[model samples]
Target: MNPLALSIAVGDYDRTRPLASGAVRIDGVDPLMIFLTPEEIFFRAFRSQDFDVCELSLSSYCVKMANGDSPYVGMPAFLSRAFRHNGLYVRTDRIKTPQDLKGKKVGVPEYQITANVWARAMLEEDYGVKPSDIRWVRGGVSQPGRPERVAVSLPADIHIEDAPEGTTISSLLAAGEIDGFMAQKVPALGPGGHPHVGRLFADPAETAKDYFSRTGLFPIMHLLGVRRTLVDKHPWLPTALLKAFTAAKELAVGALTETGTNKATLPFIEQSLEQARALMGNDFWPYGVDANRKTLDAFLHHHHAQGLSKRRLSVDELFHPSTYETFKS
Candidate 1:
């Protein structure tokens, strides 16, 4: 039997680098790993079904799954995770707190992006701000006239308007046309920066730490998606890919723990890691369904509530059956 050929596209992160460099090989597979920006990868994957396996926006995946048009069955390989507290930016002069955002004009690159979904969920759950309370402006972060990558039918009460032609969200934000903006890749603005824009949270790292302590969720942003056709054709592919990703993650973590020379450039790598462990536990960046049920369920509820996913999806419905288990020794 010949090894299956698969094209896997993901970000060039520490966890996935091993797979691209051939240090970790997928069992019974010839993997063609392409490391690319999430924007490029996602545009191609959802728009055209470009790769055999690719990193996908969890929110978009949920929407597709709910619509019953999903081309891929998910694997539990969460390649991207972040705390979205830092992604919320507001006009410092106009919006002093979360409460100030009520009945305000807020801009978003795309309402369906995972960061915005998580940020909105956080605001509603923790600060008593609801999505329908504000009028949303939608546009590109940097470019003009960008369209939503996928179509979504939102509830009637949620108000969203497109940006004026030839303008971008950054410009609207800078001009104070929108009172605030929530996006994953918000442009830089601060004291010695664009005078009008500042983070909603002054010290985002500290705020994120506090949020984690309260909620116990380090939000997941992206997951590995295998083309459904491929999965149906190759029943063994899910387990094979999952095994390779698991090994690659272990290798990356091991490399980080080698204290003699830091794998990453930032100072206090060791201390930073210890702090994360203290907050999140030993397997801080865990993969798979059992360890991540709470986080996944929370996201599903938020997704359904926000009108992004038409129906609530359980964690068990999100991934291939093979991804939930491994062979017993």
Candidate 2:
């Protein structure tokens, strides 16, 4: 009856900080939490199954899940979530709107990354721009010669071109080689740099707000994944993970609400939170299977439609059975 020790790798987010610092602990488990960049975590996780527990790209998970090649089963912790409207960058000279992207070459660090899938969903569902509508240019965002962390076999209709030998997508977009680019991590192009390089949506916040009002989806980017071997051996592990991450998030959120001193060093924390609560309600960033079913389903449809997943993966198939429900007191 010894506490099982595990190595967990994830982002250095406020919600996950408690787990690393031991402010929150998983039931009957000892965790060695390693906060890492999403890129590094995923690159290692998919390639070598690096960590016992890790944050994973939802798109890549589905791609592997549908192919029946995944080594991990997902936990609905959803450590990372974002609108992704801001992920897009475009040249003002050529692209006027999302519609303008049709038949144009757009750059993506990886076509199957979660953010790009959500961005593509926004373009296709809201405006009628399918994934096949634009010729996709695949490359690095900041550096050169980066490839997809997990190779995906896209359908015939969807096309991708490797970025020229030594060029990064940021440079290509700046040079007008690609009409638009999905800049995952912001490239160093701002005031006094590449005058024409700008965001596709001038005010992406408002655009995202409008999108949420219509779609009810605040897109999920990453999920906690447990190695399937571990899950099969320790049947209680997934729910223990769920309980720990949920508590960590609540603690982090409580700090934001404390008016005496700010836990996060940002201006107008109170007012900003008020606006967020008004839009998405108290439990805005919710966890678990039942809560995020719509968002999950939408992502599954997008993943399948865009040819990333061979078939649409159901929410049931994505996680362990114990995680799908929790014991009620």
Candidate 3:
């Protein structure tokens, strides 16, 4: 039989680039790749189930999974992962620390996005600042009128309001209308940028590194997902996807480790690679549930606590059964 024909929608990241360029191929699959921004891929996928295989927001997926509304089953291939300590922006004159955020109005693109979830969780977990500690302002970080991708019913104590009509959080932040801003992407305060725009953490990299040392959570943002109906029809597909995506990430890792020539354009490629390995081990950006159980467990608990999920989801329920166990060599 001909290989399964499918459309794979994901970002053009180095790890996924191999699959998109055909250097990596899923077993018994013929995939048409569509590279897109995270917002685009998630908006279309969650709204319409637009692709056979897609990158899904981890928090949103858990929300759907808990509600039994998800049309997709997760794969262990985390398409995006990052330490979100650097994602929080604040006013230089005020909000010097996470605790200072209490009672302050902070802007977020969405309350349920993985980056915000991790940042908020980190703030509470490490700094003892709860989500209810701060009033939330939801709006577009850079643009105007971006709504929550997935609807959420947060606890009564958690207060959130939309940005004013025709105005972005960035503008509110620049003009000191909002005390802080939080999102994965950088906020454009204005053409030259505002003098007051700054990060809550004075040294985010050091703080993130310290957090990683304390808690081995790198914080996964996105994971690969296939439609549940398709997975039901092709039981072998989840494992096939996991294998190919792992292979693709391995190739990207190899390129990063090759110090003879810089695979990435950054100046400290070799130092950065060594530092990452030192901090998180050789398999720093690991795939598979077993390897990432701690990370997933923390995220799930935070997801439930923050009211993103209907209930706390276990790590076992996050991925399909086929992805849970692989053949032993």
Candidate 4:
């Protein structure tokens, strides 16, 4: 019989492209890949369980898992990772330093989003700023009144307010209504053409590199997940999918290492590759529990501390047991 066909939705990341392009194949499954924006994937995946397999926001995933209502089980194939310092934007005249954010108004697309969680973690852990220090305003980055996908009851000390009915964080920043914004994508109008909007870190790339040099955390943002019912019905599917994703990542790394010409559109692909290698060694982006335990643990700690996760989850609980071991080649 032909393998089961599963619909998988995720970003069109280079590391995941091999699977999408059919260069890598699951052992007992036929994946129908749909490339969508993270927002679309996360909302549909979490709110409606729209796909059989999808990339899930690590923070939101934990929330559902902690609530004992998780519809999906994790596969250790992290599809997205990055240091979030670059995602922190602020009004140039109002918020100059991380310390300056104290007692200021900070905007987020969603308070429970993984990127915001990590960015807040960096602020409190590195600087003296606590999550409660700033009054958090939750809203759409470009639109208004975006609701948190998962239900979360925050700690008593943290203060989060909803944005006004018809205004966005970009508009708030442009008008100086909010002091800063932390999001995976900076608000559209708050940068580029706007003089008042700028990143909190002057040279965000350099700052991210410096932070990584000290912490050794690439900051995973998303992981692949399979609907729990599907996993229950097809017990072998998780392991098979994990194997395919690992192979796809290997292919992506090989593509990055080619120096004949630029593999990506960026002008500094070669230089960036060299820098990454120097800092993180050859296999910078890794899969599996052992390779990402530190980062995972840190994120879990923050997720619980920020009240996104009802319970602190161990790294072992985050992934399916089937993905723990791979067969010998």
Candidate with best TM-score: 3
| Tens-digit per-residue lDDT, 158-228, candidate 3 | 99999999888888898899899989988876577778888888888999999999988899999999999
lDDT of 2 by residue, 83-189 (tens): 98898888899999999999999999898999999999899989899888999999888888998888788889987899999998888888889999874676555
> Relative to the unseen true structure, what is the Cα RMSD of model 3?
1.0
lDDT of 1 at 53: 94
**lDDT per residue, candidate 1, 1-329, as tens digits?**
88888899999999999998999999899988898999888889999999999999999899999999999899999988999999888999999999999999998989898988899999999899999999999999888787778899989999999999999888889988999989998663434658768999999999999999998999999999999999889998999988889889989888878889999998999998889989889898988989899999999999999999999999999999988987767
- lDDT-superior candidate, 3 or 4: 3
Evaluated against the true structure, the overall lDDT of model 3 is 0.91
Better TM-score candidate (1, 3): 3
- TM-score list, all predictions: 0.97, 0.97, 0.98, 0.97
> Looking at candidate 4, what is the lDDT of residue 8?
90
Give the candidate number with the greatest lDDT.
3
Q: How does candidate 4 score on lDDT?
A: 0.90
Candidate 4, poorest ten consecutive residues by summed lDDT: 186-195
Report lDDT per candidate.
Answer: 0.91, 0.90, 0.91, 0.90
lDDT for residue 65 in candidate 4, whole number 0-100: 87
